[model samples]
Target: MVDHMIILLRSISAFVILLIITRFLGKQTLSNMNFHEFVTAVILGAIAANFAFNEKMQVIHLLISLAVFTFTSYLLSIIIVKNRKFRMWTEGTPTILIEGGKILEDNLKKNHLTLDTLNQMLRQKDIFDYSEIEYALLEINGKISVMKKKEYHNVTLKDLKKGSKDLGNFPIELIMDGQLLEGNLKVNNIPPEWVMDKLTARGKQLDDVFYAVKGSNGQLYIDFYNDKITHPIDIE
Candidate 1:
């Protein structure tokens, strides 16, 4: 029982410490981590795991290791941002896989990517035909960036000679998850009474709403907590 309690306490402490370190590293450490950042994360996680479960490992030693790794990663991030040559060497340059609607077989071979995998990646970006792509780059993070041919690109308002005013505005959330967003309503010049009246008209109360947004098109979109549809279409 004593051993179990010690393990539990250690696990909780390690979890909290790791959480603080991750938050200090910022959102990019999790969301947009490059190659080195990913490796650092894996190593930190392994150290934290050992601290949590390894009876032989000292908590103070693990903490020191975590601190050292985090500091090194933080220092590298600063260097990467300030030094161009180091950044290029660390992250590497993007490889051009396709240019002028022609696939570069040599680049694909060098990257160890198969034609089937390339096609799969292209399909994910909604491009089925390789001929439609003007340029496709294999990014350093292993994601593909595609540029469609001029003829295949979607027509924009500018292309049709439409002015900025013609483009519609986005919706702003006034309430989310049963909580009133007074700041959003104030930004859009909407009164609380007006929102209340709209909800009442729809046989709903503010507490019954899961989400409520006001679109620039003068539409109040309200989603109820108990909304139901008998025959829902499957998007996937």
Candidate 2:
């Protein structure tokens, strides 16, 4: 019972220390989580776990270890923010995965990514066809930033003149994962009958749709569960 109380106290101390240290590190460390931050997190977690469970270890020694790691990480983060060269060396540079609609095979191999994984990431950005991408960069945070060709670019307000329909507004979600958001339709003054009519015109039913939205241009867009891509690129 005495040992259990000591363990409980140690666990609480570890949690409190971790929370304080992480909070001081700032949200960027939590959000972006570059290579250094990732390492720091893993090491911190290991130390905290040991501090919590290893009853034989001295509390002062564990606390010192935590403090040293946190201070070094925090200092390095400051240096990284101020020094561009240091930041590049630590976090690495963005790799161009796709350029001029051409996939960089060598770059993919260097990054240890397969063609299948690249395709899946592209699909997540609603880009099934790589030909539409002018440039695709793999960011340091493991996100792919894509720029589509000029011909395939979305029309912006700058491209339009005065008295145009509201193109500034984003598309409103009407259906998601085959579930209709009736509240959205009611708020937008859209009738359920109108939605059914549009679906019927497209030879689709609610059960068949994976997602549906009302575009800012007053057009109904529907995506079905079955992608129906006859020739899928399956180069794993």
Candidate 3:
């Protein structure tokens, strides 16, 4: 009687605590969770389960443990967001699986992904033929992003006309969350002055910008923090 009531109360307390903790740690969906998130979720669940069911265990002890883990994880997430190198180390960078229709055997081995798994993922995207892929990347979330060859792509209205504009390579991110990616600028040989000039021309400062990317058409696309959208759809 008393034991059963205690168990019910413990279960409710655990559930509420879990909900609060998960809300604070919200970032990725279950389908797109990284390794760090996956591990954190598993451990949190185990701790929560013990808290809910283990009548012999001290509630305060379990709570202290949860608090330590949650705080550490939250701190790590903040560090990952601010420090790019740490982020790469913890979450890992995307690997190029296929480039120019050629599968990179070394990359496949590095990721420890078998050819069969690769084929299955590719087929999920309706990409059956390896030769059709111009570029395929294995994202940190274990999903594959593929870019098909021009010939394999669907015929667009642009293709119907002669002397169509040349679509430049993949889009390159310049400023993410108002932080300038110096490495990207250096690697792509994009002049720092160019970014400043673009921002200046629009009468905006770097801090005002939310995100900026170089489009595939070799043009700069910039978005500001203050979108100034009046009567924006309030969905949610």
Candidate 4:
């Protein structure tokens, strides 16, 4: 067995050294790491991992290596921050993935993102399809920013310019734990038959659906057989 005591001691040493080095590296290293800085980070991780188990290697050696890496990264970060041209070249700007109600297929390919992958990211922000999205930006941090269609969003009295309903439009639960919701069906002027038809059209089994909700505008959202989910299907 690997020596637990050695691992514990080495881990403690690594943590202390890494903390000091990271502090010296500054906030930009974590928040906005450029290509060269990122490469240096990977090298640092490799160096840290290799020395973390070397019983003969003193912790000071690791600390020294970390210090050098941190100094380089910190210097680069300041250079990038001060120079707009350098920043643009280093981190790159956010790419418009979807523009003017259409998917930029060239941009999508440039970013090596498939339509399915983009849709999955969009759904993370409660956006499901291209039809519902107006603008999509792939940020430098590798995160997606999405803007929904105007009709899909909540319409305040100011937006409508009239007092339509003397109430608030609340998101209603249409299905929970694989059960068809009669209450929400009645609320949305939708029959249970419509729910069954929608699910059938999608070719998704109700039992296979992990989440389903009817949002403010009576838009039905259903997630079918998501492997990432950990919960067992509730078949009531």
* Candidate with maximal lDDT: 3
lDDT of 3 by residue, 97-211 (tens): 9988899999999999999999999999999998898889999998999987766777778678854455537667898778788988999999889999999999999989889
List of clashing residue pairs for candidate 4: none
TM-score of 1: 0.67
Greater-lDDT candidate between 1 and 3: 3
Higher-ranked by TM-score: 1 or 4:
1
lDDT of 1 at 86: 82
Q: In terms of TM-score, which candidate is stronger, 2 or 3?
A: 3
Error of 4 at 227 (Å): 49
User: Which regions of candidate 4 deviate over 4 angstroms?
Assistant: 1-7, 27-37, 56-61, 156-236
Cα deviation at 166, candidate 1, in Å, is 23
Alpha-carbon lDDT, every model: 0.84, 0.86, 0.87, 0.74
TM-score to native of every candidate shown? 0.67, 0.67, 0.81, 0.59
Clash pairs for candidate 2:
none
Sliding window of 10 residues with minimal summed lDDT for model 1: 162-171
lDDT per residue (tens digit) for residues 1-236 in model 2: 99999899999989999999999998877798999999999999999999999978888998999999999999999998766568879999888899889999999999999999999999999999978887888999999988777667777776565434544333567987676779778988888898888889889889898889997567878889888999979654
If ranked by lDDT, best first, what sequence of candidates would result?
3, 2, 1, 4
Error of 3 at 32 (Å): 2.7
lDDT of 2 at 57: 86
Per-residue lDDT, model 2, residue 165, is 51
Model 3, residue 197: C-alpha shift (Å): 2.7
